[model samples]
Target chain A: MASVARKNLFEDIPRFLVAQAGIMFAVSLVTIQTGILNGFSRSTSALIDDSEVDIWVSAEEMVNLQLTLPIPAATVSEIHAMDGVEQAEAFISRTTTWRSPTGDIAPVQMIGFDPASRMFRMGQLTEGAIANLQEPYTVIPDRANLGALGLDEVGQSASINSLPVTITGFTRGTQSIASSAYVFASLRTANAYLNSGLTTTSNCQLEGDRLTCSNMFERDASDIALDPPRALRGSDGITFVMVKAQPGQDLNVLSRRIEAEFDGMVAHTQTELSTLTRNYWVGSTGIGFVLGLGAGVGVVVGVVIVSQILYASVVDHMKEFGTLKAMGASDWMIYRIIIEQALWMAILGYIPSIALCGGLGWWTFATQGITILITPGTAVVVLGITVGMCVVSALFAIQKVTHVDPAIVFKA
Target chain B: MVVSSLQSPVTYPIHSLPAPAASSSYPVEHQPRRAAIAADHLNMVFRSGGGSYPALSDVQLRVPSGIVQLLMGPSGSGKTTLLSILAGILTPTDGAVHLLGEDITQMSRRELARFRLENIGFIFQGFNLFPALTAAENVELALKTKGVSRRFARKEALDLLEQVGLADKAKQLPKNLSGGQKQRVAIARALASDPPLIMADEPTAALDSHSGHAVIDLLCRLAKERDRTVLMVTHDPRIIDVADRVLYLEDGKLTQTPQS
Candidate 1:
């Protein structure tokens, strides 16, 4: 029975596909948008997700990684002294201008980490090596921003906030949703450039028990003729502190302890920070709502298309169904025939739609450098929605079939 | 000899009727057949915006087992309506129908469908073979509905097609077959269930005289050989001579016509 019904459904291939085209378009729209949304949500917190740390200490009112305020450098020392804390490092993320070789200044989000602690790992390098960042005034820029940053090669020279710097390497997969190019630099280089009037020598030396440094220089007669020299300040403030717990230590316990011990800082596990960052972009911002609305519209459009097509097929086959009824077929039997046709349509329509969505995802990634993740789990979920759409359409067809008068077969 | 006249229609409740006696009009070997179809005071009326109209009125019928019965009537004479009522496809406005000894009028739609599947086989005028299915599949579908296994039903469907002299064309779709071949396939489907009663509405109307005569001859032989009751509606006088009994209906009134 199923085979016969399927043959009947596909008797006119052109007509059948035309009927299913609307459904396919709608499904593809939903699938592609969902893939993009998944990629966007993951990329929003890619940094926090990829950080090799167990706990993160941030300013008290910090909401997300992008909008974090500065926290005093003293938090790192306090967290390192607590129990279950094997190591802690101050991580600085600041947005500054990059002067390209062609004299184009582009805003870049610079990530500064202690290379010796290895608290953060640079993304896959397309050129050069991450170890070269140990040299002062060296940085690794993401390959995605190579055009925007206007650097030709690894040995190209550039300046960060008017400070001389060399592009030592290129990284991949470090693109952010904020559309700002990301660059990796050592802790010392970033502090010197980000905090103006801070001499490299005074930035290194620390005062007793506190991170305070000052510059003392005798005024020369020639310097007095020009602008007076300003006092040097130390780079002692950080946006966050990345902490690694000792072996067998629970991050949740350590986070709670750090929060209790500190007054002006808050501690969160890696997973918590990742979720907070994603939620800030997906919920507080309207991107998630807009994508969700698109998906909902896709579903509605799919339902309407499938229902109309199934209903039309039922109408076309009314006489045949009437004959079946006269041949002693029950209402249930007729329902089965119609439902089987619907299932076939759904399964067949989904094949091309999924393929189309996958191709679109690949093309978008290749051309625009935007990640669109079409995972296996996404396919299964979309398949369920497709089948559900067909089943709902079948229900409408069944209503028309159940009321068919078998006696109509007797008419001339 | 004719048992009843055309003007005075015979009416009897199935439960009260006695077992039929041997009739000289029928063969000696086929005597004393049981009643396969019985109706009492069957009436069907169509009420429309114009006014109430009667399709069948005060009709009572009994078709004996193992004989071919032909119902002939002019247009708008309610031959098809009466057949529909007898086949349990439609409920009479007033009257009771007992098919194969069951009161089909009292049965629900689902029960009637089951009863029809088990006892009655129908052949339609248009040949009504599912266009997508091959000749053999058309017959196998009925058997499957009767709970036969697919493999066994396939074998049996082919055998029935062979019985109807279309074994070579078993795999051909309906559109590829001639009108006579399509009708033969329909006959095979009707016999797939081994039904005790076979009902056909204008089964040969769409075929030529040659094909029409061949199909009627096949139905007559199946009825006589298998002891199954065959009832059909037709306007063709050429096939009337093949029936054991011929009933005439005019304006929903039925009368028995003696065979010459």
Candidate 2:
């Protein structure tokens, strides 16, 4: 071979430029990935945290939490009696407004539940203690109600439905869809205040091996001039029942069993509820869909950018390739130059892209309380995608240059 | 015009030339199978939108052992086309091109590309140096493309640059060089692989008279000093004196007289 010492910069400079482009593309992809994942995780977390039970058994007709159906209260007792089952509770949710301590009131969704159940008290406490919620004389206000109730701590009282009740505790993350205050008190307290005619009954009985019961509220009853001593459940109407599964018992199986026993009620597992909430938001309007679609578009743009950089570099160095071809360099040798450019770009772009995306993800999460779960697997996949884009682009660029006639160099 | 030694066309069939005549001069100590370059009745046709134009018609040539030959023609006289055919950049419409007695015309596009990379040296007009590469790097690229180890090819490229009197300009880009200097770098690139046949098209076309003469001098001297065969195409008459043999073409046919 003829001995000729050439410049070493040729090997490094083009590669560096290509890699810089790849980094920009990869960074954009990471941002999109982080944003979408954060939105999804936050929505799921909210849905799960608001539920009243660890496990919920609903009828098969209800896809998720879109609609609530009433199950006979006897089903709750049956679930509570099952082996390995810790506890079961019943609750009803309705949108309403109550009198604040300062007299100005806001719209709220009051959740009526048994305060004694540990599973129902998992919502984060902002002040005082849930123990103050021992009797009918008290109400636990959600965090959003704190300012208006003039309640800084326990022992402060607030009024609902013209009945004055003490502010036993304050809990965070209890907003029920659209920042509505979530007032948690006994079912009796809520039914009496709302005048919903709900009542409790002892008509619980067993039909065959399964327990069967009906709503306890009296029929054909007139509105009383005075408040009832305890809350009543209307015979025809009630909301949802929360069922806790026994240890080692499959929730799916229990859910199916409840469906068979009482086909009118809808049951859901915790994970199912979380997924349903995310799906609901994504399906409700065009904004969520558009954001997801925008992320997809970002990926395509990234690939094209990578491809164009490699192609341009190849076109610029046609003569160098022709010269090499005349030197008895194989086509593979020419191909390596182009491929190396892309590979280098992928490597350079990956670290900074991931770092940028990760930083952006944390910032979004902190400010909006969205959950962006950036796992190593996702990073690796994004890196692989960048590399793949580079390679495809390189292949095309190399194809064009390798065919350049060495005679053109001569003609020059 | 320079006259032919023979009164009538010599026209001796190429096959009648002793086989060893083509092989005897190459410095093949171990690998005697290496054939530098060969062509037989090579014909090239170009298809324009109007009709087909014949670039070469039954042109036959050979560089045996080590010899320097010149291809001279006016513009559009097909000198560049024939050179391109020999270097495997363009396939002859009819007839065969052999490199080291192997028929390159019969090779596939892929195989022909391999042949060009292994056996040809081309010097184009304007030197065609890569703008992004320094003088030394430009030559190293040739060796690197051929799968030569970096350490070995780097040393070799530097040596070839020194041979062309540009060892000091190895780090300079093409834009930084004078007309003659870039041509010299091109020459270094041509010799990077030490191929047996160098086909150069107007190597000194862009240079001043003095620089042009200097480039011709180096081309001739290098071919002779290294015992390598050279075929340079030019219309310039100044370097005709240095050519061991000169063939002229006019309107795609071999001509007996120079226009001047």
Candidate 3:
């Protein structure tokens, strides 16, 4: 049948375009808010999700991977002895101050891991970057943070906690998500830097606002024996124990055993640990709450404005609806026509909204050094919201339509 | 349009009716007049914030097939209200209306709508043409509502427009048409579904005298040729000469009744 409902809608082209614009405004607001929130979640849990470990043993009451407390390094040996454990490695993650060459200080998240362990998958590394980290006092910072660290090239010198160090090579995909730089160091270098506490006691002197180890500067970085700082470490501690399970091993069973074997320790399978980190960052911090609130407001405002548009459209052609009713059009058929209009608006409006969000995400990632990832999963969620919003608005407009008196056609 | 014989089968019960209404236009002298509309003991009361007000008082009317019956009354005489009840657009406060042998007042709103779609057509005073649709499309909407396919509805709408002497204006919108031309479109729309009965409420009230007479003449010619029963409510005396009978209302009461 030729759709009288559809003809009535297209009869007013300018008004229809205005309705589409309302739909566009609503969908875009939701997409942008949701995309930004997704970015925060992804950034907070990137490392936990990237690591292929079956279990992670963190400090007592460990809430998030963002700032893990120190657990005894000896706990690694205990975990390695557990059944179903294929391998275990010590990991250290901390947010510490990094002083740029020009004396500009900023926070950086430093991670120390064994190069041979498969428990972690360090993102794309430069050629020979891993082998080069074997030398003492060498650190590889992500290339994305080069401008912030005030280092223009590789081998550039920087200081962490007054301990002099040189940038060995650059890597990608390791940029710290929490508004800071990300740097990778070998266990040998991290133990020298992290376990040694705040100060370097070995011939460390401040020279023109730049900390330089007099003994460390004399030998080339390739010597590998010039760093006497590692001997100054007093205690052995690591923030996390990354555990890999044997093939066909049940991670739940292994995690339960690790928790049971050690006192004041928590064990989580890979997915559990990742979710824990994500939830902690999003819930414990006020930033995630603010972002979620913004998304909620967008949805509400979208609903109100879009419903008004739909309601106004219904009001505008109410006479035609009454005419249809008088001519024996069923309620369901009339409601179906209205729903089809909403569906059309939802699809047409959603495409441009997501495209706009994707563009905004790329622009911010490029210019502000902050990632706003609009992944396929995020797009799918936003699409659901957009379609649901329009349909709800359509149902709202139908309330007015249902009250139309078919006798009104006689009035004129 | 296929015209049905006035002698078609008497499928409905013949209600006792007033002689004048039953006598006006019986085409067949021997055969009983098929009743297109039979109403008994109708009373319409409209209630609002002020109070309850009676609009029609115990009105009984039986309109036979193939006749033009003009319902005449002063303002607020319930002429439109009675037509609305007979058309099943309004349910009487206390009465039963049987149109085409079916009791419309007893039917559900949905069933009434279905029955109206198949058996009745309407033309209103202001023409009531959908302003957004062209003349032919406005007529096509009626055919489509009757479950006619798009291609046939379009062709039938044009053919009906041609019958109303507005074939050249079929593509014009109502806003661009004259009062008589728009009325012709409304007439075409009423005839599109080929219904057995047509109802018009002051259909010529907005037109000038010449246009009003022309509109009513075109309507009566179509209704008589197709053997359709037409009940029109109007105050326009110029068009009353074309009616087979003119029923008058005064203060919501019928002034005359004669048994046939």
Candidate 4:
């Protein structure tokens, strides 16, 4: 009977509490581990996923979004001329050291975009002040990272590659999994960091209306050319050409067209680029496997703890259960009684598990600017796993209960 | 050896046991017209890695309805083993057991379980109640096991508890009740299913003489009134006057005539 299981579990309040505590610990381990994995995967592709661009065309010399050889800003011109190309912008990202006004340096990823296109959503971050980036040599840095970057306020100045850049506005807090602080600036400011815009003739100049390299990052400068030939015709350090297709245009088709026309460049639909970014972080690193192992350990710990509790309960009332068997209770009836107790443990532990996840999510985001994603779907999965583990453990314990001799009741 | 134990059609000497004073409506001779439980050439051997042990040897027994049969034997003589075989909790190593005219020993354990639920009630030496459950709830467990509806189970369990003179103890858990009250609850649970046969093993062992006599007297009265066959395994000799017949076993073999 349901009452039997209920009474058995509750007969000793201290024991029941201890059992539930173990279950809560186990479920929380699983929930938090998977939540972090989800957060890391999302952060890997956060920028790409958030962008409005339909296609991302990277230089043939590009390794990934974080490490890349800049293409000619002229690539944007070419895409703008293509059929069904609604808009195009030069999006550049590169790692550089930032020197705060206090002269402290930190590794930072500077993302440069054409202010006119505003495709990277500079306006939303600035409360419709995309024009702030229009200010010369101005940048937007996440507020969470400002203190670490040695700048404290919007008007403070910082140096990237020894070139002074002012912070005109602040973006919402964000953290890059690569351990780099994200900073948004205009293309001109990006050129300054590249040392390409140091002098009018230092890197590239406008040939008619197009910015082209007069001379690139060294035909022979060890720092400039990753591959010499690529450095020669280089777009002066523009990393990517972000394109938005016209309404009803097929993104796959447009990306294919771009790949066909460009030399040494990879054209990827938005979704493909997002997947590529996520895969690189999740598969190319050990983090995914490590998190999965943490979750698995949680399950094993849960099984052991629950099995011990149920088995201990069975032992405590060996005579009583034998009496039931002699009274003609079937094996199924005995098993159901234990399983019901397990179900109760699962149901009781689930709420606290998600509650712990929610609190951890908030703390992580607040301190590190990294989101720990815990969706309702994730909650449901945790509940299922918790219940499954408890039931399996109960069954393992009942094996011993059913095999026991019913005649033991008489002996007692 | 079997014939030496059961020398006649009657397994035990029925002439010795006094007529059950409680069963005045039916004399001892008037009973035994139909056997409520019958076992033929039963043997139970337990084999372990070390050796084999003969717990019951060439045992044959018959208990008629509406009477009490007391199984008396020394320790290790297999009195409990015989009771288990007849109740279908165990399959005898040889031969068959019939309860209420159905051959139970031939049935699978699953089938035997269902048959036991339908035809037999069991009481243990210890008042083996779930420590967490109240007295009435313990009785309700057997009623529910017999497929009684929840609506009727609670009411019937209370009625049985009252019949066992434990109306005031219905809501108390087993630990809170005295030994006598706990045994009364066990009896109530046994009668919850209203089976034709009631089997108890050392039902009075844990009680004092006063409570023990009172408990067994109440049990036999409740059972005889319902026309249920009462079979018990016990060593105490003071209960002879209350039993309709007595069977004795020695060295796993029933004696043709009890030494007492």
Best by TM-score: 1
lDDT of 4 by residue, B76-179 (tens): 88898888888888788987788877889778888888888888888888888998999989999889888899889999998999999989888898989989
> Candidate 3 regions off by >4 Å?
A72-86, A115-119, A124-136, A142-156, A168-180, A196-235, A257-265, A286-289, A375-377, B1-32, B48-54, B73-77, B129-144, B147-185, B206-218, B250-260
B1-260: candidate 2 lDDT, tens digit per residue: 12232122222223434343232212111212233555556677889998998888776565554555677889989988877777777778987777767887788877876776666666777687777678888788777765678888889999999998999998887889999999998888887778777878888789888998888788767766776767788988777776765678777665445654
Q: How close is candidate 2 to the true structure, as a TM-score?
A: 0.72
Candidate 4, residues A161-233: lDDT per residue as tens digits? 6657778877763455655888887776666666633333356678899997654333234323222112112
Candidate 3, position A142, lDDT: 76
Give residue A263's lDDT in candidate 4 (0 to 100): 80
Ten-residue segment with the worst summed lDDT in candidate 2 chain B?
B23-32
- Residue B104's lDDT within candidate 4 is 90
Assess each model's interface with DockQ, reporting 2 decimals per model: 0.49, 0.36, 0.39, 0.54
Ranking by TM-score: 1, 4, 3, 2
- Most lDDT-accurate candidate: 1
Candidate 2 CAPRI category: acceptable
Q: In model 3 chain A, where is the ten-residue run with the lowest total lDDT?
A: A215-224
Question: Stretches of candidate 1 above 4 Å error?
Answer: A99-106, A116-119, A147-159, A196-235, B1-31, B258-260
If both were scored by TM-score, which would come out higher, candidate 2 or candidate 4? 4
Q: After aligning candidate 3 to the native by TM-score, how far in Å is the CA of B186 from where it should be?
A: 3.5
Give chain B TM-scores in order.
Answer: 0.87, 0.84, 0.87, 0.87
Q: What is the DockQ of candidate 4?
A: 0.54
- Model 4, residue B89: distance off in Å is 1.8
Q: Model 2, residue A44: what's the lDDT?
A: 36
Cα lDDT over the full model 3? 0.77
